[model samples]
Target: MTDQPIRVLVCDDQELVRTGYVTIFSAQPDMEVVGEAANGLEAVHEATRLRPDAVVMDIRMPLLDGIEATRRLAGPQAADPPKILVVTTFNVDAYVYEAFRAGASGFLLKDAPPAQLVNGVRTVTGGEALLAPAVTRALIGHFAERLRPGDPSRTAREDIVRTLTPRELEVLEHIAQGLSNAEIATALFITPETVKTYVSRILAKLDLRDRVQAVVLAYRIGLAGGAA
Candidate 1:
C-alpha cells in the first residue's frame, strides 16, 4: 500500500462482492484494497493483522455476524477499534439502525456507485460518520416513535442539550431530520457558513465526534423524536 492511500479491508460472504470491491478500490489513486475476508470471523482476524483505516463489512456472515464483529472491532467496549462501514444489498431500514448501534461509521448499499463507496471510506477515515439524509430521517423517526417517556437518561441528554444555543438546537433538529448544511441554512434563513458553525458547535457541546454520533444521540435522548 502507498503511504498516502487509504487502506481498506473488504469483508463479505460472496466472492464476487469481495472481488468487485477490490477491483474498484484498487483503481483509485487515493485508496488501496489492503485485504479481503470471506466472513466476519476472518474479517476480525484480518482487521487485527492489517489494522486498516477502514473496514467494509457486510451485515451477514458465517462464524460470526457483522453486528457482533463490529462491536468487537468498533464498539464502545473495544480497546482499539477500526472504523467500520457496513455494506449491504438490502435497504432494510432496521438493519441500518442496528449497524449504527453497533458503532458503524457509515452504511452504504452494495449497489451504490463506486465513487460513493470510495467517498464513504474517506469520510469515515477523516473522522466523520456518513449518514445519508434519508437514512437519518428514518432512524430518528423510528427512535422517536418507540422512545419511552421519562427515560432515566433524559437528564444526561438534557445536560448535553442545555449547552446548545437555541439556534444551535434548531440546526441540530434539522440535522437529525437528515437535512444537509445547505438545506438547513435555507430553512433557517441563515448562510450555510453559519449553519456549518452551528454544526461544529453542536458537535463540541454534545461531546460528539461526528454526525453519526449526533444522529444516534438525537435518537437516544428523544431530541429528534416526535414532531421535532
Candidate 2:
C-alpha cells in the first residue's frame, strides 16, 4: 500500500446517512472524503468527475439504484473503474447479488460498525473483495441454479480444469468456500504465504480481478457448492 490516504466518495439517498458516512470517513487519518451524492445519478456524475479510489454505495435511490450505478461505474466495459463497496440494509437480498455481478468489490450492512465500514474502503482500495461468509452462503444458495452442474457450460468448465494445476484447483475450491488465506493455509497444511501465492496464480490464470470473481467462477463451473 502507498502512503497516500484513500480517496472516497459517499453515495446514499438519505442526507443524514451521507453525512454520517462522510464524517466517519473523514475522521480516519488514512481516508479522505472527496465527494458525496444523495442519489445514484449524482453518484455516477460525481464519481466520474472526482475519480475517487473508492465509493461507498447504497442500494436504493430515486431515478437509479446502486446496482445499475455500480454497473455503469465498475462493470466489465467500464474503463479504469473505481473500487465500489456496496452498503445496504437487507442482508440476503437479490439486489446485493446483482450488485456483485455488476462489479461491486465488497458488501456491508448499514448497521455494521464504523470500523468495519472504514476497513471496507481500505480493503477494496487494496484490491481485495470483502464478502462476509454468511452473505456468501446466502448468495450461493439463492443462485444455485445458475451454478448447478450440467448447465450447458461444459466447455468453460473443461477449460478451467485444463488451465489450473491440481493444487491450484484445490486452492480455488477453498476460495470458493469462503476460506481466508490463513484458514486455507491451515486446511491445506501449507503456509499462509503459499496460500497467497496460490490465490494470485488463480486470479492471474483465470483473468479474474479479485477473489469475488474467483469464487463466482468456481461456483459457476460446479467446482464449488453451496455448502455450510
TM per candidate comes to: 0.87, 0.93
What are the per-residue Cα lDDT tens digits for candidate 1 across 1-228? 346888899999999989989998999988888999998899889999999989999998899888888888888776667889988755455676677777888887778898888888887887657546675576557667665436565885688667888888788778877787888999999998888888888888776766777777776676774733
Query: For candidate 2, lDDT tens digit of each residue in 1-228?
Result: 789999999999999999999999999999999999988999999999999999999999888899999999999999999999999876436687678889999888899899989988988888768466666666567776655666455677889999999999999988887777888899999999998899999999999888878877777778886521
In the predicted model 2, the residue pairs found to clash are none
Compared with the true structure, the alpha-carbon lDDT of candidate 1 equals 0.80
lDDT of each: 0.80, 0.85
Clashing pairs in model 1, backbone N/Cα/C closer than 3 A: none
Model 2 stretches astray by more than 4 angstroms: 149-151
Best candidate, TM-score: 2
Worst 10 residues of 1 by lDDT: 144-153
Off by over 4 Å in 1: 1-3, 139-143
